[model samples]
Target: MADYYLAPDGSDSNAGSSSAPFASLQTLLSALEAGDTGYVRGGTYDESGFADGSDQHGTASAPIRLEAVDGADVVFDFGSGDTGGLRLWKCSHWEVRGFTVRNAPSYGVYVFGDSTDVTVENVTVEYSGGDPGTSGAGFHVRVSANTVLRDCVSRYNYDPSSGGGNADGFAVSQATDTVVEDCVAYGNSDDGFDLWESTGQRLSGCVAHSNGWDLDGNPAGDGNGFKLGGGDVPSGGHLVTRCVAYQNRRRGIHYNTAEVAMEVYNCTAWDNPTNFYFTAGEHVLRNNISSQGTVNIQDPVDDAWNSWTLDVGDPDFASTDPSSSKFLHLTTGSAAVDAGTDVGLDFDGDAPDLGAFETDGGQDVTSNVNPVLKAATPTGDGDLAFTAGTLHYYDGSRWVAPPVSYYDGSQYLTVSEGVQTDAGLVDGFERGDLTPYAGDLGSFNVSTDRAAEGSNALKTAGGRSAWADIRSTEKAIPHGSTFQARVYFTDAADSAILRFGVADQDNWLGAGYNSNESGIQLSESVDGSWTELGTAQMTPVTGEWMTFRVEWGVDDPDQIRIRCFDADGVELGTGTTTTSANQGNTGYGFEYTFQYGGTGPVYFDDLRIV
Candidate 1:
């Protein structure tokens, strides 16, 4: 029943108190007793020679609790190479949160050897693994059960020496009753999320994208977005619901090569070359959408209500831009709206909408049109009136009138604005600060040295070792939206490579330089995976600027259009991209990223989103 503190400035000799905290995690773990809570202050911790969790053990009732202080950014940097940042071997009942582990020679966090009831939440693991022809992963759990990994992100982990054979964002093997929810895995050289030789594991509300490519933009791994089962043994009876997989080099949601019984529901797979690839298995797939690729399912039993079978045309989603919160909204005219079979799942319309989300039909509400009232007896509060032509409902206290006009048999009438205005300005960098932008992990500022139109422009710079991005705070692009921007860069050699696009809920869409830096690359980030659309050659002059524009649609993968221009507005290139069927909502913000390592400064100005 004691509390301990670990800070970078404190020492082991002092009592582990708030003011006199232990300087090292090793020292604090040695003093931790069952039911003891350890608070780690904001700082960079270097655990080089320490054996992770070797001396730390807690009971089932009173697990060892290690957490970062509120609003603290705790980072564990394992310089160059190390076995692991935090290792839990043969340990049980431990809880860890709010800590980032990076640059480990092997795994960022490894839980192995019969560990159970271990919870890892709000933890980020990246930049781990350097063993050539060996294995490494951002987070690896093996022979463990009853593990919960929630709200965690794993990215940019690779083993280049092995040519990207064994490195994944998050991997679990031989584990049962494991639940991974609200998790994201992207940008790893290997698979984004993988489960091998595991059964009774459930993955919900998770995303796996842009795997199989190293940070340097080179393909060197297995590259599946979500690999369900592997190994010689059959790993069966897994459940995956409300998950998304896109832009991976291989199959999006793969059953691997093993025969397994699995169930997939309400999952979305888009832009994956092989979207849904399954081996010989007894699988149940319902209410799922695969926008592209050859869906290979062997002996599937409850397969129904998929986007591939519907001949009603495109599902007309709201927005594919991941930057917006509602990227996957179903539009009013979407073929998927109310088209799914009832599987005892609650829905908004007459029936369930196929895919991960159900569109509420609220976005289609127009001004002045009266909704038709249904004739039904009121059984609960706020129930709609069922009487024909009735626009009022009886409340417990009183009758409530509807806000809009009731539907007249002749024509639907509503108010309309006399005129429409031009699209609003998203950003121009005139504020002289990046206060309107948020950084995922990188450095950015307003620069006066270069501008495409004004005296100031947004400048971003980051190391080539990782991904860095700055995104606009406002979501300005809606369904059927168009936007453009002016970008400036010195040259291809500057290593200040940049990618401009829109991101939402772990997915992205945009174009940038290829990892090889030889040509321009058009890509879409589905979930967290990057899918290459097409490539073109357009060399940039040193110290010159270019203009780029895009038009997006709510339905059809072929409706995404992008165009590039020189400083003089000369058309350089134009192309169309494969559209994602399950695009969620509106476009939130304009994003700029220094993808991979190419140090230097990149500038942007005159951004507009409509």
Candidate 2:
């Protein structure tokens, strides 16, 4: 039994022993259905979490391979176990080259795969485990088909859940014509390469950075150091080119709704809290190079920093300063080199600049999503099915509930670009951070900390901002949910909480516990004169960001529907109530806080909730 044995041979280590080979790769998969081309010649083979070879061995025509001697580098170490490192279940024409599959608890080479035509080149899946409850991942390809993950290199991988959850370096699910080329997903917490419910996939010259943004809390937000997208459906042609995502928490190249003929060329994204968070599919982004913060495109140009056919500066890469001196440099008379625009760019020779620093002269905020008269937030939960008009609905358990955004107004208008004015004289501009800047779209004129110091319209409050604040978590939102805000009530009594529901469940103040403890049963009354007095229905939790709506059918979850519209969409109050979610009833939980004060003027949009 001597094909080339070594592991302390007592013999029959499946006959490939000069020594005593075959120490368990399932004893060479029980000697692979009766050998055809067996060669574990060199040694060290234990790729367990590598999907324990999912369906076990294969034969599209006698296809069972494991190489490393044509140029030796084989090193399957999987020291810990629970999942993948080598699993190719119903394998076909399988091929693994110049091996080095590390730590294998999760993935180093897992193609549990069916009908497999796998070919993993120059592979290297390192340090898996980024802590969001820790499950381990460096390569998790599900529903595999026509797979090819080339030139790999997955690094650090540590986000078990600081705010973010889990880690990923390469995830292509529901695969089809898949191709991941010239890869490199660094630090890893989330997307370094992710294409969900995959179809025709293609990623070229890839590069992902510090990686990981725990979202829902705004872990950092941004996906595309290669992140195609999914969930709201859509997703067909997946293609990403010349990539480079720096600081990495958001967009270096991203798509949300499944995405269609997706395309992002000559890429380079900056500090990336958000360097472009796209959702509209059938996508196409021309020559890219975006700089320091914000580039959310929906295609409605007015000022992406400097108005452009292409060309919005500063991506002198090699340094966003991760220290060593520099880390994202590319500056030298930069306007993104020569400014972009060669369209669908052909592997850069020149002409290309939109995002991912090709010499980033990037700063076309596209007007921070510019488009004022705001109120658009239904990326999904129900895929966006809102419009009851007063704020309320009940059909799940029943007990009556509807005011469709509740409002009994006198006057309110908040379709803004006009920053501080609702009369009552002053005070009203604050900056970002609330769930990543409250639905962020545009119009960011900043400051007005609390207004009143002298109140000259609160010193123009930053310059121009509609208003911002929408942060609450520790998740527990029951009863009907609908919260809309774009507001205007020009007299004085201006209020906001388009949707704040959770009528019962312990005071939601989570930093150390604060109190007034927002248990707001219901509130909506932005008076300057309109009347159903807006809504504060089923309000529970202390995290303030008012505009209201809640739908879970029935008034028990503390029943809610506090809507307020008056710009010719009138219906200020046709009330309905039944509040009590029991956090011990105690104190201020808002049976009313839609603030029914004086000076009037209000407006708000997309209040939230299916």
Best lDDT goes to which candidate?
A: 1
Query: What's model 2's overall lDDT?
Result: 0.45
lDDT of 2 by residue, 360-464 (tens): 243221110111222345756757543222223466786443211100011111222223322231112221111112222232223233222222111111112
TM-score, model 2 to reference: 0.30
lDDT of each: 0.69, 0.45
Tens-digit lDDT track of model 1 for 437-521: 4455346677788887657887765534454665543334554657777777654543222233344435656654443545566
lDDT of 2 at 375: 36
